[model samples]
Target: MDKKVAIVFWSKTGNTKLMANALKESIELQNYQADMFKAYNFDINKAMEYPIIALGCPAMGAETLEESEFLPMYNSIKSVLKDKKVFLFGSYSWGDGKWMRDWAYDAKNNGIILFREPIIAKDKPTDDILLKIKKVGIDLLSD
Candidate 1:
């Protein structure tokens, strides 16, 4: 079995990037190979080879994904994600996490199987938040 994961993210303030790193470390601790990539640099073709994918992008401009990079890359890979388990995570500095909610709804509607509910941090992740992020990676590998 292929024990690998792909983590693609875009972070303007680095919060989202931190979550990606946490996830990568957690997965690697379990003896799984986790590759990290910036949103614009990630290749969908390469991502298709993994059973698990972790996508992160902080909320931007009125509760939305980073339009230029993350959004476009996500849209391109979303359709093919139906058969794979995905973990959606990000950070938000304002609003009531509507972005994560809307994104989760869209992903579900598109037939993407969420590993769990989308996880979001208020600004930067606290130790608790990082623990949750790590747990997701552990759970995904166990699955």
Candidate 2:
């Protein structure tokens, strides 16, 4: 069997958390092993044990990243992200999703391979948005 995959994120009002859950289901739908984690409980070192990492977060103030748990968790794992296969998704209310774009840029610089363009949604995601998150999970397993 291949290495397991983990979808980790921070969600305020459950927006991004639901996205993470959907991703877990999607990967499982592909007959692959997957897991979900909140930002605070996430362990970068332990996560390093897995080959795939799916990260999600909301667009916070001024379209910057949600600083509370998102920044710290990501910063802890950022350096080792190089060469890891990653998929990114998030919910946004405004600002053209600069947060997701900035995250993708950072991952790229860290040498992680992106499976696709970032999955983004404005405000709370509908079924259509959840479907995209599902596809992201399948894409990761396919890789």
Candidate 3:
């Protein structure tokens, strides 16, 4: 089967959504399939069938994951992601990106092959930030 990537995200203020869109564009522009969906709009069962994934969300207060419907849904699939290659993305309003750090560790413990650090930015990503996200996208599709 041809290679493809799935993008699942939850964005309240559109910062994270912008990242998701850029990532999707980057992946599809590589001639690969990129499935984009809001976290609530996503179907996790179908996502596990994909070989790779890109998960995005804005860091909530005190560097915590957004406690949306997606969190519990993601927890159920956490173990199953052991054999999958995944990328994490999000936006931060304040404080250090501890959420991303701890999240990275947790996913690593579950055996997911993390590609680089989780992409993080303060509030909306500016031009430079999007450039970095684009680089992450290139990396995701490269190998």
Candidate 4:
């Protein structure tokens, strides 16, 4: 079976993008095909081609998904995500990561199967956090 995973993300200060890159590297290290995309370049129609999807967006404006691009793209693809195995990760500068919690709740309510709880890091991810992020990628290939 093809075990391809898509890592889609939006980053303003390069923190979230760094996390996305780490995920892509980790997934690829496990010998799984992983594709990385910025939210603007990612076509939602292509989402279902992969068995697993990883989304990253930092907390923005009262701990919400980035409004301009990521939110719209996510909203557009959310309905199609039903029954899809997905994971969420991101970076935050403030406000206790309420955004990730809300996102996970919304995904669950929409019937998206979450591989695990959303992974969050404050500002730029530290080396330790990167390790956790990589583990999340490795876990995607677990049976």
Of the candidates shown, which would achieve the greatest TM-score relative to the real structure?
A: 1
Instruction: Select the stronger candidate by TM-score from 2 and 4.
Output: 4
lDDT of 1 at 77: 88
Residue pairs with backbone atoms closer than 3 Å in model 3 (clashes): none
lDDT of 2: 0.82
Off by over 4 Å in 1: none
Better TM-score candidate (3, 4)? 4
lDDT of 1 at 75: 91
- lDDT, ranked from best to worst: 1, 4, 2, 3
User: For model 2, what is the alpha-carbon lDDT of residue 104?
Assistant: 86
Best by lDDT: 1
- Candidate 4 residue pairs in clash (backbone atoms < 3 Å): none
What range of 10 consecutive residues in model 3 has the weakest lDDT sum? 68-77
C-alpha lDDT score of every prediction, in listed order? 0.90, 0.82, 0.82, 0.89
Give one digit per residue, the lDDT tens place, for model 3 in 7-104. 88888899999998888888778888888877776665867778888889888877878886657656767876777778899998888889889888
TM-score of 4: 0.95
Per-residue accuracy of model 4 over 1-143 as CA lDDT, tens digit each: 88999899999999999999999999999888999888987766888687789999999989999998899889888877775679899999989989999999998888888889888999999999899999988888898
Q: What does candidate 1's lDDT look like per residue over 1-143, in tens digits?
A: 87799998999999998899999999999898999989998767967888888899899999998899889999998877998889999999999999999999999999998989988999989999999999998998885
Which segments of model 2 are wrong by more than 4 Å? none
Alpha-carbon shift of residue 82 in model 4 (angstroms): 2.0
